[model samples]
Target: MKAIVIGAGMGGASAGIALRNFGWQTEIYEAVAQVKPVGAAISIWPNGVKCLNFLGLQRQIKAIGGDMASMAYQDYQSGQILTRFPLRPLVDRVGEFPYPTARAELQSMLLDEFGRGRVFLNKRLIQLEDNGSQVTAGFADGSTATGDLLIGADGTHSMVRRHVLGHDVKRRYAGYVNWNGLVEIDEAIAPANQWTTFVGQGKRVSLMPVAGRRFYYFFDVPLPTGLKQSRDTSRKDLKRYFTGWCAPVQRLIEQLDPMATNRVEIHDIEPFSTLVRGRVALLGDAAHSTTPDIGQGGCAAMEDAVVLSLSLRAHSLGVEDALRRYQESRVERVTSLVLKARKRCDVTHGKDPLATRQWYHSLEHETGEHILNGMAETILGGPL
Candidate 1:
């Protein structure tokens, strides 16, 4: 069988790899001429790690990923630890390790594994047409490909999704803007094996180690919609916004290269009842975009790849049946997760000061075991 996958991001590449592993010929297309990963760090929890393991990438990811032993929440101004949640117990319970990895590194690995020949760049999808027996994808460069199946793994602003759903969908903002960058890790600032966050006043500064003794740090601030910033002014804005933060955070901000920092307004899509129509199916952010508060966006995409492959294998001779099964299997799980992540984002941003204060105090009283169980709930519930 032949499959055409739109969007060569992690989800699309993984879909191509998974389909190929199941003995299907898969071709992946990317709109961008050259892929440049924008996100700084990705927390690949055990669930996501398991998906990579299914793709035979666990060992390679571990080699390039950083180990996070524990997580701590601190006061942004005084740098006093509000609570410390150890993660080693979760590893023992789940029988899988969670690692933080650079987005570029992971993307490069997926590309290498998926075979570069199978991936086509500069192929922006313009339309998708599904006849009774087959589907065809139209590209902006006047190229077309017909296949038995089409996978829309394109991201939040997915063209494939727009085509499949037969309408344009607007992304809903998650009520905050985030600034992300990778900076040199210093032992004096924080320990390497810890995911540390400084929180206060409806804002947060977080840092986690990646490979090569570098930390992927991000700042989240509640801001108005449609706000824009240039590179030079964005750096200055970061400094001004975080003036009262801890010394380590201030130092980290100062060390960041103005041109290297990336500022983005976080957004997610509303839940859809289904992810498929005929031979076309949506996966990852294209299917159900979620806020990054829980770090499950990419992880969910990876899970979609595995489950969709399983469905195809089950209905090898029935492409439409496979798509129906894919939608039936994934819609409920991903929709609930999308809503959960949205709630988490709301709590983190704390649009209401009083509620936010209460939320922080509640975190102070949370036991390590409670936190571990919460993490376990998210990771252990994923598809095997």
Candidate 2:
């Protein structure tokens, strides 16, 4: 059987590889005219790394200088540790290793596995049709293709979702904007292979090692009740907003040489009740966007690809049945996760210092077993 996977983002590429692994013909349609990755570091927890390993590309990812270590959560501004979780420890416990790598590196790794012919660029989804025997996709350039299945691995603002599922889900602003900075390699701020977050009143900032030595940073701050990402904003405005956000944050803003960093805003999609709809389905941020608070956006997308392929191939390549299985298997798990991730953002961005402090203290007392169990349960489909 054949499949058309839309978007060509992390989810799409991962799904395409899985489908091909299971003896299914797969084609990826991407809207971008030329595929070049944006953003810096994206985390791949054990749940996702297992998929890469299954696809036989884990070592390739490792070769890209992925960071393998631990993550520390702090009081967003004061840099007080609330919790520190060892990623390698979780890997040992669950038999799944988590690694952090540059987005470009991952895309390259997956693309290498998928090969050139299976993925296409400049192919935007205009519509989707499923008239019993097969599912079909129409692109913006007026090209159309029919396949046994259509996977909406498209990110938020998914066209396949609207055309096939008849559901128009919108991105919900997270009451804040973010600034992304990929800093030069340095000993200060972030050491090699460690992730850190500093949380404080109405703001939070994270420093993660990308490609080992380089730093991938994102700072979150409250957005005016109904602000949208705009070009009208100025550097002075960002500097003013992030004023007094503690040491490194203000300093990071000062060193923001890249133009896009200051304008970055956090947006999430409303969690859906189902990702699979007929022969069409959704994955990645398209299906379950979340505040980047926990850095699971891409990881969950990768999981969807593995699980979807596993289920689809389980039924002798029954595309429709597989999609239904995918939905039944994933919705509850992904939805709960999206909500929990959002709550983390809430606590990190809470305006009340006292309340936020209490939350932080409470989180510190939270046990590693509880965390491991929770993390395991989120993707493993079992109680830890």
Candidate that scores best on TM-score:
1
lDDT of 1 by residue, 1-384 (tens): 899999888899899999999999999989999987758878888999999999989789898788789888888888888889778899999888888899999999999999998899999888789996899999999999999999998899888787677888888988899988888887666788899989988899898989989998899999888876867787789888888888888888878887888888999989987689899999999999999988899999999999999999987569899889889898888997899888878878986778888878876786677768877888877897
How many pairs of residues collide in each model?
Answer: 0, 6
- Give the per-residue lDDT digits (tens) of candidate 2, residues 1-384: 898889778889989998899888899989998887657667776677777888778678667645757777665456566887677666777786667777877888888889867678898777778887899888889999899888887777778667645667767777777766567655456556767777656666777776746777776777765555443454576667766666666666666565655455677877777677677888887788887766678878888888888888777546678788888887887887788888877767774567767866777886566766777766565211
Q: Clash pairs of candidate 2?
A: 75-199, 76-198, 76-199, 76-200, 77-199, 77-200
- Against the true structure, candidate 1 reaches a TM-score of 0.97
What's the TM-score of every candidate structure? 0.97, 0.88
Q: Could you tell me how far off, in angstroms, the CA of residue 337 lies in candidate 1 after the best superposition?
A: 1.5
User: In model 2, where is the ten-residue run with the lowest total lDDT?
Assistant: 225-234
